[model samples]
Target chain A: MNIYQYDKSKEWFQRAVKVIPCGVYGHFSPAPYAPVEAYPFFSDKAEGARFWDVDGNEFIDYMCAYGPMVLGYHHPEVEAAFQKQISISDANTVASPRMVELAEFLCEMIPVADWAFFARNGADVTNMAVMVARAATGRDKIIAIKGGYHGTSPWMQAPGHHGTIADDHDHLFRIPWNDLEALDRILAEHGSQIAAFMASPFHHPIFEDNALPADGYWQQVVDKMHENGSVVIVDDVRAGFRLHMGGSNEHYGFKPDMIAFSKAIANGHALSALVGTDDLKVDAAKVFHTGSFWYCAGSFAAALACLNILKAEDGPARMRMLGEKLTGGLRDLASSHGYTMIVSGEPALPYLRLADDETLMLQQAWCGECTRRGAFFTSHHNWFLSTAHTEDDIEKTLQIADEAFKAVKKQFGS
Target chain B: MIDQLKSRLNLKAVLRNLEVLPALDPVSAELISDWNISLRFSVWRDTQVVLDFHDGRCVFHSDSKESTSVNLFFSSPAHLNNMFENQASPLPLKGFTKLGFLKKEFSQLIGRLEYFLKPAAETVQDEAFKKVNLALSLNTAVFAIPELMKLDPVSRRIAPQFSAGSLQFSVDPDGPHAHIIFDGQSRAVAFPGPAVNPTAMTVFKNSEVAQALVAGTLDSFAAVATADIQLRGMIPLIDHSNVILDRLPLYLQ
Candidate 1:
């Protein structure tokens, strides 16, 4: 067995703790990721579907840098376009033509989107979307799913966190997922006060397995939002480009008034897009949203290139096909080991958990073993399949998973 | 209004709610462990009570006159109402209330208590934060400060050096009232034991600034440089306490 050493990573985490506060912050922090003892606290470098930790160990990455590298990191076309844009200029005093070009491409790609806005991250776009909703509707209340994650702004950080002030989330409503009755109950009371009902394109929680919209659930919510005069904001930052070129809205059979996208937008570039219809165009323009890095034209060029290549190659379909094969292979292997692996969400965005392991210890043990054996997978967070992942890669991953399951069974007595 | 006030001001329940911060918010708890106090809060003819801090837990009393550590005098319903609502902020406490005095004793309670504030659609925005506070007890610091501190990130770092340190505070309007004991064994903060000999002690101009300092919402370093808090011992400890006691707001997913 080739076990990756964490001497360097351990040393780095200790150093990081001294200055970085909890060693590191946010989702990327190693503490929140399970099997923490085995996970690397820092990444040295990454290119195309794989990343090397600070310790120099390599693995076939399925985390995809936590839902960013869609076109298989550092794709030549994307990189070439970005390089060309950078050679001319990135951020300038005046608005770059690339911004308009990217916006035009987005409005064209996403059928329902008539206008687009640029931001540096998903949180910025979502926050801006809320501001735009409030500005447009003249309402203060916004509703989101109970456990689904939006980003970490003051309003969206979970309720009981020590530092959250009373006013921070006073107007935000968290309702149960897939429950129409609960949705109706909240809307009945605060319907007129609500500016928007925001949620992910799908139900993907961090600890729990992902779930698709119950049949008619999405349509009903859309109808209700329309009936109540509340805007629907599909947070497609994670499920965007992966589902369809137009985003999850295209596949889900409904369109949202506002869609915020980032994560995989530019094939791992730090760029986010807020696309909406003409109705919200004036309000979107009225909202104050700007980022120093958001104006960097290089990211815009990369985004355009990534979009072109993905559409031409039909990247979503290929990713789905590869992901489906990987899911079936992993399930068979797990079943062979007398463990049932439940891969939730679509194949492109699979969330793995055990059918029988309620506490997730067994799942953690399996993922720990898999990563140790050279498959960079997350136990709790969802996994992303990309075009960079090949059929051979899937085969190799299945082999590694089989061995990992064996280790899991031996350790956990399953 | 008095009968209505009794139902709205539940100070005892508020203190009990905050007793859990040491286990949950490690940084705020550790900073709190350095102090011990038995301050008395009196609301005219209504309720007079004593609160004892023991091992990260608060012992609440109702209408018992057992020689409290300090005495808070509320002249009228309006005074108690004002104190209960605004909390730590300067109120019209007669002429020259010297709030910096009360703040020095019970300041940390503000920030540490916020970690326990649950989600609600309409939280007490202008004060009476612990909605329960609007119902029963007259003791105000426990509920009011936590509500105010929610805007700032509570400290997440746990410091071991505060374990042996102790600070006693005496605010005017209440004399020799509260004490802070940080005699824990490890980085985890606990209530200080009796017979604590302290390294440093301090008084504030009023409770307004003192609560802010202990909460780590207001920088203790900058507070000292500005002489916002009067000190009695180990200038360096008071100067550098917040370094080990604070972080940006945490939203762990």
Candidate 2:
């Protein structure tokens, strides 16, 4: 399964050093304890089941751009749609045929999305959700969970985190996530003062894969926030499109006041949507919600294609099955090697842990072992399985995992 | 007489002239009641000055500005002098006698003065911030004096344009308060928490002055000043360094 040699990657890395800082934009994704140099080989191109770097090295991609390429990289249909859009007009100026088609598709697909506002990135829609929540309730403070990645915006981080905001703009009020009792205490204490409770249904950096909320966690948060005169904002940016076409929220049988989504909607194209209830969507209109680059047509066409493919005979179901098989194989391999590994979250997105000390060192060791064999990147945070990945890819991954598991057992033997 | 007071001694104009308050040029006399305590000597700014019967109790019912000032009287002129000197303490205006026609008027001024004397803390800290304070109760780790402003050579190299500032910090079990006196100046900016957000942003931004400030490692105001910490804000006021340091620590939390 392995394609390229190690020495070639070193040369490419040397070339990268002359140009970029850290040699990447968002690739410092090693477990905190992992050695800096042993992260993973950089990517150049990817095809069905596998990808390569500038060094011409190949490895099975489980990082999956942290879940955006759910159909895997360069799916033929998705790419074809993008090529058509590019040939037509690049979809920037005149309203592209795909935008209206995509919007109508979303309204028909998701039960809650009556009106849709499109953007280029997850941060854009997430910010719009917060702004609309505030205008609907006419309150300034937002309540969000700890260790959630809503975005890097100052206002969004303000309410959930204290030190995350600037001193000049001190309106943020942070609250702990998941614990209903703590949320109730906060709601009772500051009922009239709060604007909304914005939360990601799944935990990100803390737990691997998907950390499903406790029983009735969503309902309780919504009920309590509403009682306190605050709206609810659901951050489905990563969790959306992975579990279902309507997103994972429908699985829980609860509807949020607003939902923000992006990754995986367009294979690799950049497009995001902020869909909410009728009342909240009205307020979204008043908020200044315009971004120039969001009008890119290539992304919209790709998204429409992705959504159409997602509902086909066996799309999300296939991806989910692949994810389960990969994680299940790793667990079996680890157990066979007498290693007690902790792999949390939904089988749809799995991350591994050798011990309680989930720091950088262990992450580095695990990732280095995988890279040596040919599993490209290890996010310790979340794992993504694309439709492009097949059963043969999973079998090869397990074989690599068996070798890595033995090495880990020997290295960290009790 | 009313025209003379409006032209010569309009309270709002007088406060603006002194620059003791921010400009209220667009606001009208009717809106003075909503002005924050920071705006001093403005028209109808305070309901009326109060004249206490015991030590702190007071009554002034007149709505007219004419009768408000006359009815109020201070316990002693010396007490009034002392009130201005110590800005931290409440002003004293205790004694009052029914001075003929003035009795009804001074009562109104007493009510307005009470409203004017509300603390600045009430205005700057909003309701949301109050909830945060309640949610987080801290037990701080204070740094020792020698560790307060220990400079690092690497920080200086990274921030070559660094200027040394004399920094002081105080550590309580709850949190650290830092004050930096740039170049031996007494005006220090006080930062309330561990140097976190501002320090991290500054380090990321490649500012040597911020690097020096981090190297100073200030925790609170009690620690001694040293030539380790550096500042790069609106400077030249060394004694007011506390204001700068005070705001820096909040970002860390």
Candidate 3:
């Protein structure tokens, strides 16, 4: 096999370094996980589960553009709808009727969604959710899970984080994720001041394996928050429409007063829907929320199309099967190679954890080899699967995984 | 720019400074006593520090990793000093009193950082503004944004969330107008040059509004609405001004 080359990518990166700060910083920085010389630095185009880099190398994408390509890259149905909408008018001062159609569809599909508001990203939805909850309860403080990613509002970010100040995080109260006792203590101490409790449907931080709520955890937390008159906000950013036709709250057999949706809602189209119960609708309406391009009709059109396909294809069930297959296969492969792997989170949004490797050195080497062999996934972050990944794609990925594992054995001798 | 996280995070220096570190002012400590503030500073190229502030104490972590709760990210030393020095000046000191959260001792924190950065300049002067801009801009002016991904996956994701053109905060009431421009990508350039033909510019009528905003006194929305402020270009850009202006106090190491 030809060794990976990054000549084109390196040139592009040098240009990017001049203008872009930290040169591909954040989750997009590939130098941390994959070797700088081996990783393809820039992608040229994408379709289905495949994307071509600037160097003309193609790979089966598991990053899924960091959790947006649910139906796949440039999905025909979604793009067709988007193109049709753009041919007409894309954005208007007065929002299009497409919003009404999308909102109505959400209400019909999601059990907790009595009415919905639209935004451009998960951060906007979660930020608005916090405001709506605070407005409804007239409380200053909010309770959230520690290490949860709720979006990029000042309130959600850590103190001293660039672009934000003290007031941003002053109202937040963080408790350990899935810790019932910690939740009780926090509630007992500051329940009245708490306006809302926000969290994703499952645990999916980049550093560790994603975990779900413990048994009966959501129910107890909900009951306690409701008793204290605080609102419940479920952040369905990564798990939106991926776990169930309804909200992930429904799948978990619990409910939230407000839910934030993004990622796969429009099959990679940038859009976020904040749905909430009827009781919170009045307060939600009063918030001063508007964005210049938030009312893009093309994204709504794509969402409408994507929702239809999800229902018709029963996308969640299919995704669950796919996840199970991938998870089982990877686990088996790891065991055969004298390694252990733990798969966490929901069926569709799973996290891979290698057992007993403290520093993730082995994990990094293995994933780097797989990436060189033209497979796209990350050792540090969780991998996302889309409906676009066929059984053959998974089989091929497993074969690549087998060889990659062998390479890891050669390098580290584990 | 939150979703565009790909690989490089220069949060090391800020973390180190916060951890093994600076003597924080009492007011700053009190404000964050109930909150945990994580800061990442990229000092040199690829070198970063991760800092977590809890209960008025700061802890330096082993790695310059990402945190969802990071409220401030400083790309370099100059950026951080600019924020602190701007906040320290007494001219904008009046505006801090107007803010509800900032009213309580936050000025002391700003002043403390200002003192730490400039340290009285060996002689005291009545003209506070002269001292701050001189001290802040003395060592370095602006560092070029390390360009890596402009159209890549993560870069592509965040760029669309903002407007296509540049956004600037025109903060000078004096000559040689200073403005910070967000190039609609990862870079936010602070220019001492003329604020010529800006795509969108938020002009501070005076230094008070500038200090207030930088001191974290003025609620981002209120700063634009204030009588001392004048906005040009798109109105939406003014609304999103916090995307650039709020990052001033951050010294990205």
Candidate 4:
């Protein structure tokens, strides 16, 4: 198989850097895309489970625009809903009935949601969750898992990230995920001061093996936080609809007081939500969290349509089935090539690494090879599976992955 | 914390570069070739480092302050830091006898270091000179990380999160290389040259890219995106290290 070139992608990136910070910033930034030559810097178009780069290289995308393109890019139902709502009115001086309809839909769908709050991005809702917790409990501190990501808020960023000061994390304490002893100790010591204990449903840190909550971990954590009068918050932004229709917490057999949902919520539309128990409804309203685009009706309509389709079709289960087949095939391929491919986290959002090389150099090369061969794979973050992916896509991806494994073996040896 | 961290960086990272200056610059090497002496810099029981010059080479020692040497004392870390910045002078407790060497020869050596570290735009046009300057700057920046981690509040917090591993930073093919080994704790030791089985590595594509990065002329994120800098292995080590690297300009400038 011939590898792709990115001359046009490079040209666009050269132009981008002059006008945009780092060409593409945030999770889309190429900082994590090593052997960056093997990856495209710009995309020309995207459609169901695939994107064509500016250089005209087509890729079977597993990133799904970092989790938004869930039902698939340009999902018909979601787009039609958005278009119908837009044709009437999207953003206006007053709220649309779609907003109330979406909230009511969420309250009925999610097990823990008594009310729903809207926002523009994952960070907006996550930030509001913290504020609501603080307002309800009148506490100044928060406890979170060390590597779990909520959003890019200063307090949510790791201690040494650029543009963040030491004081920004003063009230936040981090404990290792699933470390019951650490959690117990912190709750025992500073529980009264902590307004909330925030975390994702599972540990999905980058550049490391993703971890699921140990049996009874979340239930025990919820009980302990409640005993300490601290609110339990689940930042399910990344794993929300992909895990369960109600919430990931429902899948894990535990419940959080609030669940922040984004990513797959509106199928690529800019919308996020924080749904909470009735106990915090007043506090949530009192927290005074609002964004300019928070009242946009098109996203609400898109979300309602998207969730309805997902629930009816059992989107999460389908994704899990597809992910299992893909991962299993890739693992067998790696084994055939005399390599060990470690797959972790939930099947729907699987994070894979080559156990043959702990340095991950081989894995990085393999991922780059796969990308250049028309399958977009990243060595760092967990890969997202969508309903759009089919058995054919999985088979083609496995073929590309097998070739990638061969390329890596040829470069680094067995 | 700022003064203490700055002082440690001055003595450990900045002054320590003098040990390699001889190999990079002939004039400075010749000046110290005939000398056989050790200079001890101390900050009132806080911290100390010694520089020994012999056989046209300078070696840095953090262990001993013994033997035939000149002793330079400072009242505090700030005093030492001020001396490094040329805002103050060190009190020669025992270095009075060798004041001429300290004043003239050592000053010239430091002058040469400063010239390379903070080069004139025109001087860097020379490819050979630019390479040496990049090496010196890279060395200083890499070595400063451990020092910063020990005292800087942000770095101290970040240090403990690093998984136990060695991270190597080098230019591709043939160029200066340095490695930092972390024990998965807050402790890190930096050494010049390649590491044995480094868990993580960042390699600049060539001398020109390395120079641009060291001089702060290139955006590292952009460079990485463009494949001018290739990264491999445990990325968190490189990620955390870059945070410390970002602060070098604040102290080194």
Candidate 5:
């Protein structure tokens, strides 16, 4: 096996830092990449389930652009729909019919959606969801899971994060994930002041094992929120289409009053949505939320085509099958190398770590080696599987992972 | 909140660095070599830190003892802070015999420290001077986090969020390193050198990167993106620590 070098990637990054803040800010920043030398800093191009770094190293990408490239990079049906819509009309003075069509499709597809609202990113819709919840209940407080990430809004960011003040979290209360007793306690004290309880369908916090909701956790949470006259919001932005066609809530056998969807929604297009029950439709509209480019039609067409293809091809099941095979193979490979790989969360979106090292240094080194060997794996974040990943890709990834495990063993010990 | 944190930082983090001045600088070592005395700085009803000089070295302690040495008292945190800022003077309550030593050798030692901490443009061009400055700066930055976490409103709120573990910050290849250990109960203890089995780590690629980051001449986020700095392990701990680090310049400057 040949090792990869990133001279060109490094050069581009050197240039980028002069012009761009953090070179590639947000989730794409290389700050979290352990042994940063082993990872490429820039990409040249991407296709189905693979991308070529600026250094010309090809990788079997498992991150899927951190959950945006769902069906795959440059998915044929989605691109064609976007192109057709743009060639006729996209951003126009009068909104295109595609907007209505996409909303209708979403309302029909999602179990809880009676109406759909559009936005440009997950944060836009999530911020709107909070406003709508407060408007409906006339309350000032919200309860959320401790580590649940909604978006980068100041209110959503943890207290003491850069540019955030202590009062930013004044009305927000956090409870541990799946702790029903904590919920009961909070409701007992601040029930009337609580407007919403928002969280992801499953816990996928970084640098820790992902957790699924307890057997009756969501159902009980929903019932309790209703009794308190507050609404339930499922921030399904990251795990939306990958879990279930309707919503991740549907997969968990519970429903939320609103489901915020993004990431895989338009198969990499810049679009997000907040769909809510009819009871909150008036409140949602009255919140007075709008973005300049929210009426763009090309992404709506792309989303309609993408969702239709996902429904036809059973994209979630396909991703789950692929994820299972990949994780199982990786686990066996770890065992063979005298290591224990703890895999958690749903099969479709798996977070892997090495049980051999609690500090995660070993896992980080393994991930770095795998990334350098052409399987783009991040140690801390959950890996996303897409319908474009075939069995061959999985096999190749396992081979790379095997080599990575060997490299880690050679560096550390058995 | 700012004044209280600044005062604690002045005593615990800033003044505490005096313990290392002898090892890092020959002048300071010589000045303190013949001295056998403990100097205590007390803010009324608040905090007291003692610096003991003996055997060509200095050591810091949080607890006070009934030793025959020197004691400087301040009426409040603001009074202590004003002394650090050179706007006021401490009222010596004991050891009138050592006042000459304090005025001459001790004052010169403090001058040397101030020279390193607030270096002139030409002095910083010297490689050796730059190295000592970077080390002291790193020490001050790491030591101040615990004080801020205990005193600053925003940092106090963030302290409990840290998982109980040690976070190591290091400059690569034989440069300085420091550790901050969180007990998961809003208390943190900071010390010099690498931590064993740290829960998280932030490493600068070399002395150049470390100096740039510590001096605030380089953007940290840009450095991370360019791999001049690397972060690993439990990232939330590192992230929360960085947030506290962000406020360091406000007090340090």
Candidate 6:
């Protein structure tokens, strides 16, 4: 969808720049990232597989709001749910029944989720999880993998940026992704002092070096954490619901004490949840979890609709098949061009990478080109295929990828 | 500010250098000539912080008896521009005792002053930015994976719980990249994406966890219970990660 020239959005952006501090919430859609002139236009309206800007230009969306619109913008089923909820009355109360309904639905869908807590975004839920873990374990230390994008919270940033952290909070540790020997060596020494080790299985497209786990990784890690009396918190915010109907854990065959999910679960509505096992549920209860607008009924309705849609008519399998096809074709294109490209992750969260140290710059350029070509997705990230992306949509995306791949090869000299 | 407080507390000599900006100017090119900080945002203790009438960067204080003799290092003009454009508060709040620079003491006074000045909405934003940077730089540095993961609140609530005593973190920011030590092993982990860009990573605790995370492993890394590496000993505190990440820009500015 074209957002560049929309009159209302343009007016809104201009008016917002005058008053609002950053004219946006958080980091996702901030100004420097969405420069008004150089970048794509601001969006005005969106539908399945397409969106329109105030300037009246239409484009095929790929970014999916950086992974929220798994069902695509304004999918009929999801939008209908939101509209119906609005008609009933939007509840912005302290704790709405809609939240409870959504929580119950999540518990039913996810295998290990005996109890669930709701929030507006993934960061809110993550913060709550840390607080809960501290209260339960009566510890303050935590473990996480390096390059794992948890969220924008300060705790996550502590282990991220080298010089950004303030002097007072120097507790968060960073570790490389997918290193078993290092994991064992460190945990053995510090197990008694750690509070929790939170991780996401599919960080970006390539798990570790554009590959998956070796074998029995999850079980070993869990056992080690249990032995040390440390808890394992898995952040499946993006991977959840997309991998399987019961959650990604069912596929892995192991379960984490706690799991946080968002994005697709609500299908675009502002909703996220933290689900924990029965024993771990007690730990989650120890923290002070609060939010002002978390219980919005519209988001709850959207979540219920999204979950129902996922379970019915082999929805998960269909999406997976399409994702595979898209990635498979992209892989073929990359190989034929004699350019080494890596495609990692499940079909739902398929990511492609040009095998080179300068991948970031190359990907950034490719993203800009994709925008110029009328696709909202960025190559710096992954391609999120939604139910809205039909067979025809897949073919179109393949064509775009092929052309984009050629341009990438030419620019990067594959 | 806190150095003076320490003096009030019967500590030794305290030296304070508080740089305050004029309050009334609209922060534009036109206001450069008439800019003065005699009142409003300029008042600090008994000194009135003021800007030179000629150049905006030239700062003045009523307490500086030897304004000409004291060779004070002025912030670059471009740096001041960044403060308004980027919402960075470039004001200096340093307090020194006879022994050395009392940076810690200064931090507390700035923090308390920020708290006291929070009610004034117009002035609060700048003060908030300043305090967040100072507090983060002075007292915060997180070194735990769980704390990093706790950056996401939804995940935080349900994340595995561990004892602080059981986790250990060793971080060194001496090179182009910062190295984190956990599980008693230190390996260099590249910075995720960029300074402010969101990024993530997942590490395996053992062979089994590694296998589960490799190839087409679609299952949760911790799904199949197996013997794996244990976690222990996280450093500093969790709530202070923001200070570390936010304070970096302050130094550059």
Model 4, span A340-363: residue lDDT tens: 999999888999999988888889
lDDT of each: 0.69, 0.53, 0.67, 0.90, 0.90, 0.53
Candidate 2 lDDT, tens digit per residue, A1-414?
A: 342355555555556545754333332412121232333445668886677766666778886777688786888898999999989877466677778888888888888888788998888998888788888888877777655777767554322122342442255555555788878777777778788887775666432334578888888887877777788877888778877777667867677778888988898788999888777767888999887877888898899888888788457688778878887787677667665566676666666665423322344456557766778646345777778888998888888777666565577652
Poorly placed runs, candidate 4 (over 4 Å): B28-35, B63-68, B85-89, B92-115, B118-125
**Relative to the unseen true structure, what is the C-alpha lDDT of residue A56 in candidate 4, on a scale of 0 to 100?**
84
**Model 2, stretches more than 4 Å misplaced?**
A1-22, A27-33, A156-165, A206-210, A356-360, B1-253
Interface RMSD for each candidate model?
18.1, 18.7, 21.1, 1.2, 1.6, 19.5
User: Better model by TM-score, 2 or 3?
Assistant: 3
- Candidate 3 lDDT at A263 equals 89
Better of 2 and 3 by lDDT: 3
Q: Say which prediction, candidate 5 or candidate 6, comes out ahead on DockQ.
A: 5
lDDT of 5 by residue, A11-59 (tens): 8988888899888788888878887788897886999999999878999
Q: What 10-residue stretch in candidate 3 chain A is worst by lDDT? A: A29-38
How many steric clashes between backbone atoms does each model show? 33, 63, 45, 0, 0, 136
The best candidate in terms of TM-score: 5
True contacts kept of each: 0.00, 0.00, 0.00, 0.79, 0.71, 0.00
Clashing pairs in 4: none
Candidate 1 local lDDT, residue A74: 75
Candidate 1 regions exceeding 4 Å error are B1-253
lDDT of 6 by residue, B26-124 (tens): 232233444332211222232222323335432433334433221222144333333324344444433112112113332343343333323255654
lDDT of 2 at A237: 85
Per residue, candidate 6 scores C-alpha lDDT tens digits across A1-414 of 222333555455556545764344343332212112323435668888787666666667765666678777877888898899878867754556777888888888788889999898888887777777777777777878765767877777533333334432355655666676777767777766777778886555322233454578777778887777877787877777777767776767888788888878877888888888788677676667877777778888898988898788456677788888877876787678776567787787777665552214455445455555566554444667777778887777667666766666787666
Give the alpha carbon lDDT tens digit for every residue of B154-246 in model 1: 322123223355544433333213333444332222121221544444455555565454444764433332335545343223322333222
Mind sharing the TM-score for model 1?
Answer: 0.65
User: How far does residue A117 in candidate 6 sit from its true spot (Å)?
Assistant: 1.2
